[model samples]
Target: MRLRLRRFRPRTGPHEHRVVQPLHPLRHASLRDPDPIGHLLADHDGLNRLAGLFSFAAYSRHTVVHIPLRDGVPPDEGMGELVDLVLVHHSYGLRPSQWPGLRRRLTHGTPLTVRTDEARTARDAAAWQARAHRADRRDELRHTTHARTFFLFGSRDVFAEAADSFAYAAGNGPLHKRVQQGDLALVSAIPGLRQPPGGGHPFEVLICFKPYPPYAHFKRPGR
Candidate 1:
């Protein structure tokens, strides 16, 4: 997977700045695939890539990645397409004021506990509701996590831009309901420099966002 670096800034409020730690795929040949368990293996008791400012994890059989930008990029035109999955750790992902709450949650829990797990549980519940609402559940995609990680599913044509609201629209009608349900967020599609092993099919982008109240204000386009 290819990686890009960026930063997050709160629109308003006090913030705790996180350090930027880079992920080197070359260090671990086994990282060819962005597997959640792979990330844990790489964690090495929180000393590995999983502990870095930017990292990836496996959630619900999908590769979930996290990234912490050093400077705010504001989701501009320069944003590229990501290959596999990306994890973003920043206060902007959630409401500006909720940062402290998130930090407290993380600190109060076990050292290894990730606050995002709370959202993931919420996401699973939402997905179950979605399934119940649908008449045909065979093809339904479950909302596995609520980390606000954007995914392109290897669709390089997907594009993203800075928006005044938390919502996004790519003109995919069938996805509208899912987007509205907070199952996913639209983000600028970025091209990662790394390709899959043996130059196989295109990789996708998955970004795990920081949990906070700021996240509740997301208003997608064409909602």
Candidate 2:
């Protein structure tokens, strides 16, 4: 039998990258911690205040967040909040099902873990030019390194302060829908960021708050 080589599909395009799925068995096991969502709700008073402001229209770093009508706020009133959690680096959309996993990790103060395929290698600059479409993607395949990072957010003002420089995976659909429904929306920051800068060794951490299905397939890094 003749073997056919499978074509590589880049993680791009509007709907192509949207792989929102449920937690894998192993990831589900990690969520055994006691009521993590409740803990977060109890902890952040600032989050509680601005939790209602979730819907926004973004262009570049500028976003106009619309406050819901529940607080008797004017329907025409659009509150401005900065967004820093745009999932640009990776193209996959955020999965609502993974919220529990994220909650578990946050409650335990554990960094989100990711395992990439070791077989795939990063394309060189010349190679990247050949595949010009993936211009936003960083890191070489062979150089895939593990990152230990946690999520962070303060007041809704902070969220409204900076136009997030990152991109979101869900394009602009469910992300807006979930927030409108009053679902818990959050952004995770790279780990060790809370400490003063220049205090720890320099490490590159990804910013996009994309929670993938447990054990998602990754191409082995190429040499």
Candidate 3:
């Protein structure tokens, strides 16, 4: 599900390589606090402003989110305000009376919890590309990883360390839809981003305001 969005055009020698996200400053803003969940919601009002888009429906857990393209505002404007990836909870367990083919993935046992950490592996260009496709697939073949991380999780022990090798599952698609996860962040695709209340130079900018830090699937340095 590739959504036709706008992008930024370079003005000089080479194209700028500045990447941004939807949930950033807020991530470290309250780093001294305890509640990771609360820290995740510091500037949630920005995300809440997009309630009409995200939700937690299926999956081993019902955690869902919806990404909204502010009408005529192009992705470059809302990049940091939202993410470009997600976990694969879409076609999971389903009840015959509810969603037959999708109700068996999470059998209603103990709610699963995911543990997140800074992905050092991503710093390696080769490693980053090896797992790039699965990190934050807003689409099947389109990708870009700048400020990504490693989202680790497990079932039996919600607090246990993450699985040996984990990845960000893909979602339905990125056009006219809602909710997803990945090394996703809301960065301004184009240079001049102008959204409500926070429009400025660079045309637009990704405000680093996500539930988790962007997860880079890892790639080769100069890829």
In terms of TM-score, the best-performing candidate is 1
Better of 1 and 2 by lDDT: 1
The digit string of per-residue lDDT tens for model 3 on 112-209 reads: 22223223222332333343356452211111211221121112111111111111111111111111232233321111111234634222112223
lDDT of 1 by residue, 32-77 (tens): 1232211111111112223222212222122223332212222221
By lDDT, the best candidate is 1
Candidate 3 runs further than 4 Å off: 1-86, 89-100, 103-107, 124-126, 129-223
Could you tell me the C-alpha RMSD of candidate 1 in Å?
Answer: 19.6
Give the Cα error of residue 30 in candidate 2, in Å. 11
TM values, all candidates: 0.21, 0.18, 0.20
The true-versus-predicted C-alpha distance at residue 179 of model 1, in Å, is 2.3
Clashes counted in candidate 2 amount to: 23
- For residue 84, model 1's alpha carbon misses the true position, in angstroms, by 14
Error of 2 at 72 (Å): 36
**Cα lDDT tens digits for candidate 2, 26-91:** 111111011112111101212222221211211112211111112121112122221112211111
Q: What is the lDDT, from 0 to 100, of the residue 147 in candidate 3? A: 21
* Decreasing TM-score order of the candidates: 1, 3, 2
Considering summed lDDT, which 10 consecutive residues are worst modelled in model 3? 164-173
Model 1: lDDT equals 0.26
lDDT of every predicted structure (CA atoms): 0.26, 0.22, 0.22
Candidate 2: regions farther than 4 A off? 1-153, 161-193, 202-205, 208-223
Which stretches of model 1 miss by more than 4 angstroms?
Answer: 1-33, 36-177, 185-188, 207-223
